[model samples]
Target: MSIRILTAALFLAIMGLLVAQRFSLPPELTVRVAASLGEDAGYGFGEGLRRGSVVETGDGFLQLTIGVELENLDQAKTILWLAPNTRIELERLYEDEMTIRFTRGRIIASNETDVPLKIKTNYTSHLVLDDVASFVNYDFLETIHVIPLSGSVQVNAGSSESLLTPVPLAIHETDPVTFEKLEVNLEAGDAAEFYRWAGVLTGL
Candidate 1:
């Protein structure tokens, strides 16, 4: 073979390998659709999600509508229940670490093991180290609600951060005029009702 042709073929082979490695599915990060309700329930990567199918957000952003239970099999079994109008993308899903970004709506993440889970919104981020179950509602750009079922939650808003208990509170971003973060506690029965509404939306 000519030297130029051989060199070109080698370069193409290397590029193909690099692309596959970047986009290939991780064997450790296994996901499945445990339960799906509603007609809009499907994979964000196009086409409907099937049982035991590995799901990735693909390139760019992705969203999940009502009645979707995406389960991740790691040391800690994680179940993500999507409420209505919930738009989210999984940035990483590993045995010890996981990151999920929520664009809007609500999602309930149930972690059965001790793996660390982190959730992100447009203006804020939350790290779940102790809490196994947490609910995040990104209803608006300025307001976010966080409910930690077990342990505590670390709330990060811009440069400031706070530790929250099981109080079920809402974090409001501090506007330049106010220069103060706001947290609104939910009413007594409102927490339960919120979960109930989420369940109803997901048809759980």
Candidate 2:
């Protein structure tokens, strides 16, 4: 009888240890603040960012004069450009998913891995995914622009949704969320300018 009691006690102790380990394990993934340019381009959570600082954007503007890369969170890479007035924040970030919220500005996201990327703006949300995909999110005053530079993406606004290929698309903030495609296109000069801006910032 004493032997059986001892065995049961050992089993309980093992189970307790297992449970403690399970709950105490460190997080598998984190959003590393890879690089930042310009002044005041810092993170929330009150921790100073170095090469591998895990942080999230705060309420104020990113103050990104050149560019910033929020990388290595669940195999995702997000490049933010020089938006002086735009408000950026990271709403949720986990092992399998990430949500980026911003008021106005532009961002380049490269998420060709297994983890999914979600961009939340003032009026629209975009799900970005592809085997070898790259996308751009440009938030204007009255419109939100989504450009699929390489692969494809799914754009969602209100109750409406659409799949975007390598075309430039825009979603008006006042319109109902539907699968309606607007006639707005990124002009050649504008595209050139945008590419130039992105290229310059990327080089820095």
Candidate 3:
């Protein structure tokens, strides 16, 4: 009888440890303050975020001057490289899909996940999985621009959803907010495109 009791106790202990580990793991959607050149390094918006933290669905960010790097560690292998003056939110986080709503500005998305990775803007929808791309949502007079870097980004404009596009393959080097980033001579743009790049600081 004592042996049976000991076995049951061991089983319960193991189950309790598993439950605690699952709960203690980092939130699936985690936020890391993007690197910035200036002292005011982080901006907060939507639902009184006030500071960067794990985001659940419906957490909106606006005019994020300091930029925020988001990673979906559990549900997806993805990261969003945000530019300043960007507006976005964690729109949906589900088992089969993950989506980020881009209201304005730009993003450099790196998505390598099995789940469908989608970005929705006001006018279009994009599938950016299995690739890295840059997406612009028409700042100022410019229209939505898509520039794929390594792999292809599937775009759907004027439909019910929106996807993002890439900038000049060389755009990553001129990170407007970062004072010191690993210099990726990853792009070369024209004079006009370079001019537009200046407005990235304020998300114009």
Candidate 4:
């Protein structure tokens, strides 16, 4: 009888240990560039702007958010990462270099300029960015609607938006942005076509 009791206790202890380890395990999130608005904006998956952390996950998706900026507005560039349920806000404008990255639960941004910058997010609706200068990157996010809160912001395709060559803009929708694939690149001159393709891919 004593032997059976000892065996039972050992089993319980092993089960407890297994449960603890499972709970302690960290979540997994991937970072990808979501969007950009300026003419001179630059982004890449390698080098100084390629770090990410896990934030949250549900239904085979993770969420993240980040904020970054350029230092000189005359030199340097920026990059970004994307994750599930990510939100970011831009606090400064016209920087020389700026980068934002998001992955799983981790979000990272680097600013070389002397001025201050910030990025905020709304996770309740998956991902919602309040500012256009602020960018987002994620594979799960299909459609991004730029709704102007005050004046108006341009959604540049390749780099910068000019008075003669206007940036493509889209109205916000009640449905979530969906995407078949997520790609990150510098704005060139095809803002309208790219956004139109994204809309079709995301079913928005």
Worst 10 residues of 1 by lDDT: 58-67
lDDT for model 4, please.
0.31
Which is the leading candidate under TM-score? 1
Poorest lDDT segment (10 consecutive residues) of candidate 3: 172-181
Model 1 residue 200 CA deviation in Å: 12
Give the winner by lDDT: 1 or 4.
Answer: 1
lDDT of every predicted structure (CA atoms): 0.54, 0.50, 0.49, 0.31
Greater TM-score among 1 and 2 belongs to 1
Q: Of models 2 and 3, which has the larger lDDT?
A: 2
Top model number, lDDT: 1
> In the order shown, what is each candidate's alpha-carbon RMSD?
7.9, 8.3, 13.5, 17.1
Compose the digit string of candidate 4's lDDT tens values, residues 1-204. 999999999999999999998786443222343343232123322112222322232212211122332332223222232222443332223332222222222232323334322332232122112222323333344334332222233333222322211132232221442222223332344333333322322321
Residue-pair clashes, model 1: 0
Q: What is the TM-score of each candidate against the true structure?
A: 0.57, 0.55, 0.48, 0.22
As for candidate 1, its clashing pairs are: none
| Candidate 4, superposed: residue stretches over 4 Å from native | 1-84, 87-96, 101-141, 159-204
Off by over 4 Å in 3: 1-28, 34-76, 158-186, 189-204
